[model samples]
Target: MRVLVTGATGHVGRHVVAQLAEAGHDVLAMTRNPATAAFPASVEVVRGDLLAPASVPVEGVERMYLFPEPRTATEVVARAKSAGVTRIVTLSSGAVTGGFDTDFQLPVEQAVEASGLEYTHVRPGDFASNTERLWARMIRADRVVRYAQPDAPSLAIHDGDIAAVAVAALTEDGHTGRWYDLTGPELLTRREQVAAIGDALGEPVRFEEVSPVRAREILERQGGWGAENAGFLLGFDDYSATGPSFDDVDWSATLVPSPTVEEVLGRPARTYAQWALDNVAAFR
Candidate 1:
C-alpha cells in the first residue's frame, strides 16, 4: 500500500514514515521542506503544506497519516477522498477523549470521519518527548530541573509508541472508526521523570520545586512548547486563554495508565526510563 504521511518531518510523523518504510510499504513523506528532511532511502519525500491543502500529493496514495491542521482539515480530507484515498489515520489528541479539545484535533477527526472513508484516531497523552523539550536545555546547562508541580503524575507516552499505534491503524484492518487513547505503561511524577533522565545520563540531577508563577515565567523565557503552553500547564490560562484554568479540573482520573498502546501493538508500551535513555544525548 502507498501511504502519504503529512507533516512527515515532525516528531511523530518521522517515526510513522520510518516504520512504514521498514514494513515494505510505499511511503510518501510530505513535508514543508523536503530538502532538509531525512528518511529511509525507500521512502519518497514530497513537499506539501497543510495550511495550503491543494499542495498535498495524493496521487496513487491509498492511505494517509494526517497531521492535525484544523483550519484546512475539511478541505484536505475532501481532496484525499477525491484522489481515491481509502483510509486515513489521524494524529489526534487525548484532550478530545476528556472533552477539553474542541478547536484543534477534534475538528480534524470529525473531518475524516465525515469523509465516508475508513478512519482511525490515534489520541496520545503527554508525550515523553515533551520532557526533552521542556528540560533538556536546563539539564544540559546545569543538571537541574525546576518545576511548579514536582509531584504531578504523568503517563508520558513515547513518540515512537504513538507512531506504532498509528502505523497499525493505517496498515491493519478492524481499526476503522476506532479511537485509540495511548499512554505510557506507568505513571511517573515530575521528580521521578527527572530522576530517570539523570539515571540515563549516569549523573545526579536536582529537582527544585518552584511556585507556579515563577515556573510560568521561566517557561515563558524558555520558549518552544514550554513558552506556548506555560500558562495552561501552570494553571493560569487555557487553550483559548478564556477557558477555565488547569486547576479547576480534577485530573486524578486522567492520570491512570492505559493499556491501549500495548493492546494495539501486541507488546508492552515503552516506559519513561527507556525514553529517557533513548534521548539521553539531548540532556547531555
Candidate 2:
C-alpha cells in the first residue's frame, strides 16, 4: 500500500515512516518543510501541511498516519475521503481522562471515522521523550532539575513504542477499530526518571522540589508563559504530582498503563531508561 505519513519530521511520525518502509510499504512522509526532512532513502519525502492537507497530492495514497490537529480536521478528512484513502491511524493523547486535549482529540477521531475510512487510534500517555522538554535545559546547564512533582508517577511510553503500535495498526489487520493505550513496561516517578537519565549520562542529576505555585512562577519568568497559560499548565503539573489519582470525577480517564504495546507488537515495551540512554547526547 502507498502510505502518507503526516508530521513525518516529528518524533513519533519519524518512527512510523521508518517502520512502514521496513515493512515494504511505499511510504510518503509529509512535512511542512520537506527540505529539512531526512528519512531513509526508501521513503518518499513531500511537502505538506496538516492544516492544508488537501494541498498535498494524494494520488495513489491508500493509508495515512494522522497526527491530531482538530482545527483543520474536517477539511483534511474531506480531502482524504475524496482521494479514496482507505485507512487513517492517528497519534492521539492518552490524556483523554479529561482536558482540553480530550476535547481536541475526540472530534479529530470522529472526523476520520466519519470520513468513511478504517480508523485506529493510538493513544500514548506522557511520552518518555517529554522529559527532554522538562529537563533538557536544566540538565544541560547544571545537571539539576527542579519541578513540582518529584514522586508523581507516569506511564510514560517511548515515542518509538507509540509509533510501533501505529505501524502495526496501519500495515496489519485486526487493528481496525482498536484503541491502543500505549505505555511503557513499568511506571516511574519524576525523580526516578531523572535518575535514570543521570545513569545514562554517567553523571548525577539532582531533582529539586518546587511548589506548584513557585514552579508556575518560575515557568512564567523563565519560559515566558503568560499568566493564564502558566496556571493552566500548572493544573496538569498539580495533577501529575498526585500520581495516578482518578479522584477527579471529571478527569477520570488520566492515562494508566496497559499491555497494549506488547500485545500488539509481540514484545515488551521500551523502557524509559533505554530511551534516556539512546538520546543521552541531548542531555549532555
Candidate 3:
C-alpha cells in the first residue's frame, strides 16, 4: 500500500513510519520541514504540513496515518478524501471517551467519524512516554515535586505498541470500523511510575507534592510547558484520583495472539527500567 503519514517527525509518527517501511510498504513521510525530518533514506520525505493539506502530494496514496491536532484536522481529512485515500488510522486520545472534554481531541474524532472512509480510531491510554516530559525537570534536578497523587492508577501504553496497532489497521481489513483502546498489561500510579524509574536507574528518586497553584508556576518556568497543557495535565492528575470507568471491555482479550512490542521493533519493547537506563543521560 502507498501510505502517507502526517506528523512523521513526532514521537508516535516516527515509529509508525519506520514500522510501515519495515513491513515493506511504500511510505511517504509528511512533515512541515523536509530538511529536518529524520526518516530513513528509503522513505519519500515530503514537505507537507497538516496545517496546510494543499502542500501534500497524495496522487498514489491509498491509506493514511493521521495524528490529531486542534488545527486543520477537518481540512486534512477532506483533502485526503479528494485524493483517493481509502483508509485512515487516526491517533486518538483515551481522554475523549473517558469524559475529558479536551476540545482538540474530540473534534478530530468527530471529523474522522464523519469522513465516510474506512477508518480505525487508535485511542491509546496515557503513554508511558509522557513521563519523559513530565519528569524531565525533576530528573535533571534529581528530585521531583509533584501533586502528591500516588494512588492514581494509569495503564500507560508504549509508543511502539501504538504504532503496531496502527500498522495492523492501515494494512489489514478486519480493523476498519473498530476503535481500539490500546493499553499496557499492568496499571501503575504516578508514584509507582516514579519508583519504577528509580528502580531502573538503581538510584533513589524523591517526590514532593506541592499545591496545584505552585505546580503550575513550576511548569510555566519550563520552556514548551504551555499554560493550556499544564492546566490539562493538572486536571488529568485530579481526574486520575477518581479513576476512569473505562467501560467493561477487556482490551487484552480483543488483542488476542497480541502484537508484541518485539514484533514492531524487531526486538523487545523497552520496559520502564530499560527506557530509564537508556535515557539516563537525559536525566543526568
Candidate 4:
C-alpha cells in the first residue's frame, strides 16, 4: 500500500514513516519544507502543509497519517478521498475523552470522525518527551527542576509507542473507528520523573516546588505555548493541587494504563523510566 504521512518532521510522525517504510510499503512524507526535511532515503519526501491543503498532492496516495489540523480537515479529507485514498489515521490527544486538553483536540477528532472516512484516532496522554521541554533546561544549567504539583501523578507515554500504534492502525485492519488511549506502563509524579531522569544520568537531581503561576510563565517562554495555552497547561497542576482537572473529575478511575496500545501492537507500552534512560544524553 502507498501511504502519505503529514507532519513528517514531528517526533511521532517520523517514527510512523520509519515503521511503514520498514514494513515495505511505499511511503510519502509530506512536509512544508521538503528541502530541509530529512526523511529516510527509501521514502519519498513531498512538499505540503496541513494548514494549506490546496498545495498538498494526494495523487496515488492510498492512506494518510494525518496530523491533527482541524481547521483544514475537510479540505484535506476531501482531497484525499478524491485522490482515491481509503484509510486515515489521525494523531489525536487523550483530551477528547479525558478532557485534559479537549479544547483544541476535541474539534480535530470530531472533524476526522465526521469525515465519512475510515479513521482511527491515536490518543495519547502526557508525552514522556515533555520531560525534555519541562526539565531539560534546569537539568542542563543545574541539577534543579522546578514545577508545580510534584506529587501529582500522570500516565505519560512515549512518542515512539504512539507511533507504533499509529502504524498498526494505518497498515492493518480491525483498527478503523477505534480510539487507542495510549499511555506509559506506569504513572509517575513530576518529582518521580525527575528522579528517574537523574537515575538514568547517574546523578542526583533536586526538585523545587514552584507555583502554577510561575510554571505557566515558564511554559510560555520555554515551551513556546501561548499565554492562555500556557495557563491551560499549568491549569493541570492547579487542578491537581485541588482535585482532578476536568469537569468529569475522576483521577483514580483514569490512573490505570490503557491496554489498547499493547493489545494492538502486540508489545507492552514503554515505561517513563525506560524513555528517560533512552534519551539520557539530552540532559547533558
Per-candidate TM vs. native?
Answer: 0.96, 0.89, 0.81, 0.90
> On residues 37-102, what C-alpha lDDT tens digit does candidate 1 reach at each position?
989999999899999988999989999999999999999999999999999999998888887787
lDDT of each: 0.92, 0.81, 0.73, 0.82
Per-residue lDDT of candidate 4, residues 186-237 (tens digit): 8888899999999999999999999988877776676542343566566644
Per-residue lDDT of 264 in model 2: 90
Q: Which TM-score value belongs to model 3? A: 0.81
**Cα error of candidate 2 at position 111, Å:** 0.5
Candidate 1: which stretches are off by over 4 Å?
240-248
Range of the 10 consecutive residues with the lowest summed lDDT in candidate 1:
238-247
Q: Per-residue CA lDDT of candidate 2, range 1-284, in tens?
A: 99989889888999999889888999999899988887789899988887776676577889888988888988887888788889999888665424435456777887888887899998887788777765787789999987787988877888898999999898999989877767788879899999999999999999999998987776666563234356654564333332344444453234456888989989999999999998899999
What's model 3's overall lDDT? 0.73
Local error of candidate 3 at residue 189 (angstroms): 1.8
lDDT of 4 at 121: 91
**Span of 10 residues, lowest total lDDT, candidate 4:** 236-245
Question: Who is ahead in TM-score, 2 or 4?
Answer: 4
Off by over 4 Å in 3: 143-147, 236-271, 274-281
Per-residue error (Å), model 1, residue 11: 1.4
Candidate 2: where are CA atoms >4 Å away? 97-101, 220-233, 236-247, 250-256
For residues 1-284, what per-residue lDDT tens digits would candidate 3 score against the true structure? 79999889876898899999998999999888888787777899988867776887677899999988757888888888998999988998765656553566667777877999999888776777777777767766755536546666766677777888888889976788877766665667778778877766677777777876776777777747434467666653433324443343344433322234444335544455555565566566
Cα error, residue 167 of model 3, in Å, equals 1.1
